[model samples]
Target: MPISRLSDLSDRALAPRLVIKVGSALLVGKEGARRRWLTALVAEIAEARARGQDVIVVSSGAIALGAATLGLEKGGRGSLADAQAAAAVGQIALSGLWAELLGSHGLTAAQMLLTLDDLEDRRRYLNVTATLTRLLDAGAVPVINENDSVATQEIRFGDNDRLAARVAQAAQASAVLLLSDIDGLYDRHPKEPGAQMIPVVEGVTREVHAMASTESNSGMGSGGMVSKLQAAEIAELAGICLVIGNGQHERPVARIIGEGIGTLFLPRRSASARKAWLGGRLRLKGSIHVDAGAAVALRRGSSLLAKGVTGVEGHFDRGDPVAIVDAEARVVAHGLSEYHAGECAAIRGLHSSEQAEVLGYSPRSSVVHRDQLVLK
Candidate 1:
């Protein structure tokens, strides 16, 4: 069902694991950090935690804050080196502020700086997920930011909007809240005379994407309506609801959940269906060929063990999705490999007990764990 009005958001739907993306424009100002806005936002987060909802914040402002601190200008004129230096300096300030603000509310905050490699590499992806889960379990809010200090333009996500959507998927979040300069998506640019606010978007159709303005509204932020729409599409594919609203208001988080003052993008699939969709979208990076007995074991719901006598067929990194083929060369399943191709080549046909001795260290016994595998 589409949510065309504020009344459509119920308390039951509101209480879920939420990933909130805060833009640089809302969090930074001329002098420095916007303390008043952050204080209120932290209070809202604390209130949500009290209501038994786990919240993760994906924030953007390190570059802006750093640039402000160094008296450097914002925008395209800044060099890559300048941006990196600024991020290094600004991240400390950003994390420190979050810690202090949340501390006052009796909540602990954990800082996590991530690069694209962290999510794309299988081992690092699992590690990150585990760490975030542990932090949430321990009643701490995770404050995440892109590792801009080390990331190059070629590998960077560029905007936190897409990063937040990926984080929501990784954390298995039920909802995502994007706090932007504007209140919600509009049928046309809100500045236009006849533009209309769209309260609910069932899906990100081409029409919805076309509604986004080409130019960003905030000079401090990199993402515009187009990026938010892209994020909404990603969230929708993950079966996670996304809300885009104005962060300039007092108690913005509270208003979003309580009053539903935003454009809500409804999820089109269930969690299981979403997973299946993801499996389908992955391009096969490699293929692992298994013997008949191993194929039968796989069909019987066993994890793909190294002893299964697999032949690695391509160069791929750990966490890259690969096809699993039987003796007949028929593709039977697809999954994220626990080890890279070279590691698999060294340990193939080895017993679980011998994995540590062969590899010098055993990260895991299964080459492809059942949880990561999807049967055809």
Candidate 2:
């Protein structure tokens, strides 16, 4: 219980499941070339697998790789589209390196590109979880990245750190390892004269935020200390521990796992699996109207019954996203509807058992099952 430093925290005592995020700054250096750091990082992951650990890597390097390939890499501000094009070019090169390196270690690597919406919609969220789980079960490592090619300004995760945190929550990992160019957070910028290293942090209090800086290190990546903290907040709320460390060190992943060479973040109370899936994975498309009594029932941990639904307002299908609201029109929860708009209209005020008689064919017992309903 006397945790003094990150290295003191035993890997055996920690969560066995993990989500590791490597930033672009660590993947490539300022000269617009691949860094030796990635070789060591992949070695660490292979070693972790040797010890029977489940690992999912959320990595950022496509844009950096793309820029290097084109020989037009520069350290300057550019348009979002320019960066996106770099990502498109880099993703191919990045995957090639990942596949080759991981394959050498006798491990298979699968590439997964995701955006914010994948984790926001209930159905798609479940699908993603299922795919990741299957890959893990088959003893293959999944390398995840943001779908920068098609992702618009509004839907992008903004940075891979935040995307990693969401992926950690979705996979219900025990911990999230954020590897970057910097070794750890500092009391001030590492370049500052009086800057001191504070090793272990418990929560996102004012003291923690004070350590964050907005300085960017890589032209290929957009995150800084601020974005890392934002990602940590999300992972912490999901009961996923995080460690921010330098990727330049040889076997950095192994050092963090066995030797603990990073700034460790403790987790808060863990969210339920269903709630985690709902919060981390599902995307909402529309809203449904409910009575005041139904809202109260939902808040009190009850299923969304037919008597509670006042009206269906969305142009969604049976499995389309919809929100459950109260008489005052406040959103109570979000879930996929069992009945479509026309079907819901036909049995708006009917009881659960009467759904079959009214619709002539019941898709599900509850209009929205408790499993599908996520409380706001």
Candidate 3:
């Protein structure tokens, strides 16, 4: 089969569904300035819609623009209260701009704000999916962003890159386009001598780690190459094709989908809702220390057996986040707990079948089922 170019793909039948993530850097420009890209972006989306492509846009600009409007100079890490205030200011301004631009293009844009809890909880996750599906079905473009205005540190998505990946997974998109200021991932910063462009990344590793600089290059975004790579890894695991490229060029979205101007990361073998949830859901809240044999079994993708658990620490209930730790107390993976810490302690050394005798009430046999566990 012949290789398909980005332009070819764009001009071809639009994908069944696509998640377009526009970074703050592109939306806010340099020094937290707004640009004309929104107009062009709306045009491209309109074109895609005309071609029968269902598109959901995950946009970042609230914090950047909010800081600028407030004369804060930059959107640095600030107190939670302060950041929330900035987001409140920015979200209002950002959504207004999107509504105006998209309206001019004869497209309606609906703002959907989300927090980590909404994506992590199974019911809420499905609800979000249903709403986006309805919006697309109604010929509306769902404009998604992290619920920064009201999200606390405990429930925040932290960054838009991660938020986009989760949204892509939830929407079950066929492709995710990550638009940034930089063209693509490079072996070294292009500004430096002898830097080479990497067109395709199969998977992220230390080798590829050298290809990305550790810091953010965007003046208006907190995301850097590292975060993009991490986001790609998450999206790939969710079986979604991820493309990274620049949004500054004329028709960059069209070019990235059509001409192939950026780096493309292929999806993994397969991804399930459970697996994607495990990998992208709740942050590790505590550690469950297990013996060596259990650690080896977990590495082999087996479920956590009660006999392997040595001790449990911290507070976590059923469906709460917890880490699977080795005897040496190193985190090997993270997953949702089947039981609380006290319950787990009572049954730590018991066999799976003997759970009822130990805990008085038995839930599932495995402490953390393989499907609910994501290895680090």
lDDT of 3: 0.79
Model 3, 118-218: lDDT tens digits are 98888898999899888988988899999888899888877788788889888878778888878789998888999887888776676887778766676
What shift in Å separates residue 85 of candidate 1 from its native position after superposition? 0.8
Better of 2 and 3 by lDDT: 3
Clashes of each: 0, 8, 6
List the candidates' TM-scores in order: 0.72, 0.71, 0.86
- In the order shown, the candidates' Cα RMSDs to the true structure are 8.6, 6.3, 3.3
Window of ten residues with lowest summed lDDT in model 2 = 1-10
Q: Which parts of model 2 are misplaced by more than 4 Å?
A: 1-13, 30-35, 71-77, 257-259, 277-376
Colliding pairs, model 1: none
lDDT of each: 0.81, 0.75, 0.79
**3-45 per-residue lDDT for model 2 (tens digits):** 3455533353455567888878777776654546677778878
| TM-score of decoy 3 | 0.86
TM-score of 1: 0.72
Residue pairs with backbone atoms closer than 3 Å in model 3 (clashes): 6-257, 6-258, 6-259, 6-260, 7-258, 7-259
Arranged by TM-score with the best first, the candidates are 3, 1, 2
